[model samples]
Target chain A: MSEASVMTDELRKQIGVAGEPLVVEMEKGMLRKFVDAIGDPNPLWSDEEHAKKTKYGGITFPPGILAAIMMVGNRPPIEIPLPRGLDGGGEWEFFEPIRPGDTLTIECKIGDLVERQISMGKAIFIYHDTVWKNQKGQVVATSRTYGLKY
Target chain B: MAKQLYYEDVEVGIDIPTLVKHPTTQQLVKWAGASGDYYQIHYDKDFAIATGLDGIIVHGRLKIAFLVQMLTDWIGDEGKVKKLACQHRGMDLPAVDMKCKGKVTNKYVKDGEHCVECEIWTENPEGRKTAPGTATLVLPSRGK
Candidate 1:
């Protein structure tokens, strides 16, 4: 049927793979707001003195907060011409906590694309895997996020 | 010398205090700044709606982040969140009053660690469940 073929046509071709060594900076205000927005009152993310008493030794975001540092389409070899998209699912692995004022670089790889259609529209799933490392090149967290293009 | 909740302290039918979070476009944008997620679907409403979505949709990870924070705050640093999973059940429209809730479903001990499993969900003002999932955590011993 035409619909099935169109669905297949909508399949996203991996036009490109994002480059590695992508670095991102987190400002203090932004980190504070994110912690506040999530209502995570833990001193770990805000209080430098309190954080110093812990293993991390300074204010730091939660391990899961690494999900915030992945920048899609920000650099070379990025996916081209995506029309519609949605966050489908993701998997996370934590090695260490991310701290404020740390400039982190993400090592990234583009995964296979999946195609499908529904009442909403024809959708293409773009999958990306990334590893976050602190300025010291220590791996902090890794994640794979799936986004849909319709 | 931290405390851990026991399986005996929790009941199957008891409800955990619900948290309601209403994420606005500004908030999502701020999340973008903090998280480095530039997917236009989160910021560009016109383009987002053109895709047949009612409006811009919140990042699935952000929603999970909220859930994670809630569970972590409840369990504390001495505890560990072993695993959490969620299925995208509904759309979260921007600036809408959305509610997040969780309930204790199961409890047990493994490797001498007390653990609790909870059912979590987020809903819209219309009372429609958007994100539903399960979370597993290892709590410290209650006597510690």
Candidate 2:
């Protein structure tokens, strides 16, 4: 008996294909909620007065907020045959500060796929690349997230 | 908040201040709500155990948040995080002490930007690195 390959031809076709674009508005309430969940006491993310004195001149969301924002929009789902999935980690590059009232367009796509043997036996790693652009059409941030299917 | 860290002030191989976090089940719940990642393994212990985990595990993204906080706090308000990359190699249980630590690896001027690089990671109580990563920061130069 032999195990079937998790990376089928159909799955391989998804690589480099862009998904639907998602637009999200930066709201103070949502930013606060995200900062609160992280338990970070940075005044830049909470206190308007304190942030006003900083170079940012107003409250700014932390880079960590990307973790939450990336989850808000829907993307085309790539069905994998693996039973369990785990977050393998991610890489992010920031080019702008996210502030309240800024509308952002997020585009995501499957960057690549690879198969490897791990302690869990066999796993398929899917890399999702996401780009965030502000209303000005400036690229604010880009991230690559890895998901492990085992 | 700490004093601003300038590119001139950072020395290669020096350790940055560490940020320690104690993540409880309640915090995990808050994270699940905030992140929109209501994965049962992060909040429901029974479901997590059913999937072969010891119990509920801390969210990997939450640990990434901790590491980001550590870097931002070290860089101060004038600094900016340019890039961050990490790998989730191990799982952490709730209520455990997750220590975020980093050491400056290199510094240089690129495209007229003062850049500093560091090796960052979160360590379990037993001194094992659960999530190891690297970060690049742009700090204000004293000359400017």
Candidate 3:
């Protein structure tokens, strides 16, 4: 078997087992930072009064902002020992606006391992999926990201 | 309220305003702080080059974020982003210019909700598509 296959098999074994649901509380500051960093000037994401006049009732985090936090949460804790990795790719589907004060519970799963060889070294790619739901049990978003490790 | 771009206002061939971003190492670091993507490829030039890339590359997710923002801002609040998908086509290096632009490609109305479909892409200084994708958004209308 290829080195990537071996690593993937080990990773599959690690699995983190069953994914534990995580509750992410939406905050305006985090949302604003993302908007500013991305250079988005949409008033709906930054303006409350204007947003309230819309169908969404009030201000909401843009879909990309919703995905950004989930990507942030996918990292290894600083204290943990881990190998370096590359970001291979990602995909996301937005089902609803992520409103401030809304707590989102995510259903996460580690996907299959994909292997690719590069001049640098042998790289293993893994896909991860996270589904976000609101306190009302309504599905809000689904985000998938790919990470590469040597 | 600003006037919403209705299905009547958009045509399949019209171009939308383009977005430009000056990606620097610091910006990547800042994005890493917010994104929690500590992958070496984003910040380590030597490591990235080792991976066969000329230099450190921007995160694919970050590019996707910019594309989504471009569309939603154009469609306005009453508009809803229905679907978005992108395929990475090139690499964006730090201290380089990346331009994002889009064009309306399709339009339709379903159950009283008007929708406009757009084609979006990012270009490097060499004028190559870095990332290309499509988005479907629901645009508000006047009435029945």
Candidate achieving the largest TM-score: 2
Say which prediction, candidate 1 or candidate 3, comes out ahead on DockQ.
3
For residue B73, give model 1's deviation from the true position in Å: 2.0
Stretches of candidate 1 off by over 4 Å are: A1-18, A25-29, A37-39, A52-57, A69-82, A101-103, A135-138, B1-15, B37-59, B104-115
DockQ of the candidate models in sequence: 0.37, 0.74, 0.49
The DockQ value obtained for model 2 is: 0.74
Candidate 3 clashing pairs?
Answer: A72-B35
- Computed on alpha carbons, the lDDT of every model, listed in order, comes to 0.68, 0.89, 0.73
Tens digit per residue, CA lDDT, model 3, B79-124: 7888777776667887888888899898888777687888888888
Clashing pairs in 2: none
Best by DockQ: 2
In terms of lDDT, which candidate is stronger, 2 or 3? Answer: 2
Supply the TM-score of chain A against the true chain A for every candidate structure.
0.75, 0.93, 0.79
Fnat for model 2?
A: 0.72
Off by more than 4 A, model 3: A1-18, A69-85, A111-125, A144-150, B1-3, B44-53
